[model samples]
Target chain A: MTVKELAEKMNLKIFCGETNLDRTIEGCYVSDLLSDVMGNAKSGMAWITLQTHQNVAAIASLKDLSCIILVKGFEPEEDTLQHAVEEEIPVLGTSQQTFETAGQVYQLIC
Target chain B: MVFEYPVQGGDFTNAGTVSSKVKKMMRQLGVDAGVIKRTIVALYEAEVNIVAHAYKGVITVQLDSDKIYIKLDDEGPGIPDINQAMQRGYSTASPEVREMGFGAGMGLPNIKANSDVLEVHSVVGKGTTVEITNNF
Candidate 1:
């Protein structure tokens, strides 16, 4: 599924990079722990989590994830946003819980 | 390119910066994806532990044709039990650290999983040294 479709399906707000919404998502990982997400989420996969921190962007960069979806409408710190912009990681915000977003992504990708 | 990061203690905000820089350097160096990724993940988790729990430390990264060598040295309270600390989900991080998407006790384990070679040495009340080499 494309990032745009996942956003619409999960009712997410585009914090940045609405242009790449049509990019295809290859996999999904739901985790707040950076270690687990990196170990489990393969590159080019979408990471769904409630974490919004600089470390999250750092992890995304290291893990080479396609994008990050912040569930439950969580707001990231300004530094986190800046880092995401610097690292070129597309970030999405959603009012849905982590499980809900996972379900939506599972339907689309799996 | 060679890189070195001075990790300050208790500064969760700056945690993982070294690993992040290493990620970019690996990409710029035209290293393969898996090798670049494995090194970054290994080094970053160790760096986070330094920032969160240790007194202070420095991380040095050197890239070569065959391997990326990373060394992390810190003056924090050393691990008393290497066997126990290596366990997944075993963390001494404070609650505040947990709230920041860390302290889930996966730092050491993750580092080991990502590196081709891993070695750790520590003395209680002294410090720790973590050396990781990821082969390309």
Candidate 2:
């Protein structure tokens, strides 16, 4: 599924990178740890996390993740949104907790 | 080609600036996506180390047809035990750093996993130097 499709299916909010919603999604990874995402997240995966910092965008870009999903209704910082726009990687949001959001994403992608 | 980028310690605001630039450079040079991915992962980890632990550091990158060599030399309190530091889940990052989702003790291991050749040398009172090589 594409990022837009996943967002629609999961009921996620697209805060930025609307231009990149067509990017393909191959998998899902849920983590707040930057290094863990860096070391393990695969290309084209949707990263579900509560990390709202700008560095999360860096990790998503570096690892080629498709999108970032902020759980628990957390909005990204201003810098984070800016980086998301710059990198053309979609920053998404959901009101559900990590486990629920991740499960939904997992079911959708897998 | 050779390039140098300086890193400031505790500069979380610009942690991945150097790596981002270098990644763009590598892409412009037509580096393979897989090789670039590995190289950037290793380089970014090293760059974050400078920001996390050192007072300051310089990242020197040398790119050639067959390989890319990166060296990071920092001035700060160095690692006393390279072996322990290499182990996963062993981090000395401040609480503030950890709160930012870094310093999980996986940085060096990730570097080692991604680089073709990884060399780390340090002196406790002086600083640390990390050299990473990734072949094209």
Candidate 3:
């Protein structure tokens, strides 16, 4: 699935990287733990997490993830947004709960 | 080939700035993508630990043709059990840190996975030192 589709599925607001919406995704990992996500997540996948921190962006950058979706309508911190912008990463926010968002993303990818 | 950064624990906002800079430098230097990815991942994990758990600290990076050496030292509450801390999913971070998507007990483990050599030394109630070397 592409990021644009995800935004539509979750009814989220995109804060950055609109040009890459057509980018294809292979898998999804739902975790608030930066380490496990970084250590195990496959590249070019969408990452769903409730935790909103700059470290999330750092991990996303290292892992080369396609995007970061903040579930449950949680807003990102200033640092998180700034890092995402600087890295040209696509960070999105959703009003759906973690479970629902994961299920939606799973259906799209799987 | 040598880079050093002062890691401030004052704000979680700046935790990954040092590692980010190092990552940019690697890109400019045209280092191998795989090597740069590994180094930055390990460096960022260590930097986050220092800021979240340490009172204050510094991150030093030493790079050469063969390896990248990163050293982090912080004057915060030290780890009491190195073995326990090394275990994956064994985190002692507070809920606040966990809310920030960290403290999943994967910092040290991730560092170990990304770097070839990792040595940790912590004096309980005093400070902690983490040294990691990534072979390119």
Task: Pull out the clashing pairs in model 1.
Answer: A4-A21
* lDDT string, candidate 2, B1-136, tens digits: 9999889999888999999998999999999999999999999999999999999999999999989999999999999999999999999999999999999999999999999999999998899999999999
Residue range with the least summed lDDT across 10 consecutive positions in model 2 chain B: B10-19
Q: Please, what is the whole-model Cα lDDT of each candidate in the order they appear?
A: 0.84, 0.93, 0.83
TM-score of chain B of 1: 0.95
Docking outcome class, model 3: medium
- For residue B22, give model 1's deviation from the true position in Å: 1.4
Q: Can you tell me the CAPRI class of model 2?
A: high
Per-residue alpha-carbon lDDT of candidate 3 for residues B32-86, written as tens digits (9 for 90 to 100): 8888888877888899898888888988888787777889988999999999999
Give the number of the best model, judged by DockQ. Answer: 2
DockQ of each: 0.75, 0.83, 0.64
> What lDDT tens digits, residue by residue, belong to model 2 across residues A1-109?
9999988988889999998999999988888889999989999998999999999999898888999999999999999899889999899999999998887877887
Off by over 4 Å in 3: A9-11
Superposed model 1: Cα runs more than 4 Å off? A19-22
Candidate 3 clashing pairs, residues 3+ apart or interchain: none
Better of 2 and 3 by lDDT: 2
TM-score of 3: 0.89
